[model samples]
Target: MQKQDTGKKLTVSLIVLALTVLAAIITRLTGLETTSAKLIGSFAAVFLLTGVVWRFPFRFYCMAFGFEVLAAVLGSALNLYHYLGFYDKFVHYTSGIVLAEGGLILIHALAGRRHTPAEPLLCRLFSMFFAIAGAGIWEIYEFTADNLLGINMQGDNTNTMGDIISGTLGALTWFGIHTLMHKRQQEKQ
Candidate 1:
């Protein structure tokens, strides 16, 4: 199983790398140097994350890489965010879900290390807060980028608030679903 997972990881990593190169080409053709650079940087970050979480399930890496492709490639490089006003919100919502998953993974890892089961309530709280904190940190990044780099990453106050709200709602949705799943799993045991 581990060997199979390793092969799968290699395949997925190659696909992502190829997509990143394609996105870079498209952005470069459109003269969007900044967007191209950002996309490549995003790919690098995702690759690093894969190395860091190599022991985790492939699905988690897929989730993170999928977000990078959606947000960096399709959204920015393809300029989908500008054409589709809701795309940004959708991305933010997905980010929340991803962050929530990250939180769950972390909790599970810690529990395994301690040779104990994760507490249900603690897991839920961690997931929710991890997503919420991630949202906050993202907003801060946008703000800082906009202010320091003279880039309009955050748009106006309304857009920023909407992003935060959307992310929070996503986290809530994930929490509800995860709770139900956990309950079902426990009942089965």
Candidate 2:
């Protein structure tokens, strides 16, 4: 059943990638030069990253990350962020959650069978730290792009601060849910 689900997810992800490619082509043909280039480059980067994630043993995490990337790219391509004021915040929050999941999966893989269940506190801390660090790096990238490429990736200091806060809150939210789920599972056992 899990394998079947994973297969279905992979198929959907592939379809999303195809659609993104089509959108990029359309954007290019329509003469939206800046948007076309940005869409194409973002799609390519996301596609390559998804490919790398696919190699990992954690199928679910890979799929989650792939979907998150696709959604982010789609939002950018369609100008959703411009139309919907909160769309950018949504993406940042989702990125934090997805990245935290990736961090947890990494820790799980490293722990191996010897540690069937790794230390919960350590896992939570690592995941939160990873999300926060990723958010910081992304801000740095936005700042650099805005200055060097003359793109306004970071609208203002308030926007930057809001993104960081949203990301951190997302990580904390994940931790809370994870703790609850773990406790529930323990109670069941």
TM-scores for every predicted model: 0.85, 0.80
Q: What is the alpha-carbon RMSD of candidate 1 to the true structure?
A: 2.6
True-structure RMSD, every candidate: 2.6, 3.5
lDDT of each: 0.84, 0.74
lDDT assessment of candidate 2: 0.74
Residue-wise C-alpha lDDT for candidate 2, range 1-189, written one tens digit per residue: 357656765775676677677667765676543465568666775566656665455555455655545454556665567767898888888778877887788788777856677898798789888988888899999999999999898999999999998888878887888888888988999
lDDT of 1 by residue, 80-172 (tens): 788787999999999989889898888888899999988888998899999999999999999999999998989999999999988898899
Model 1, residue 179: C-alpha shift (Å): 1.4
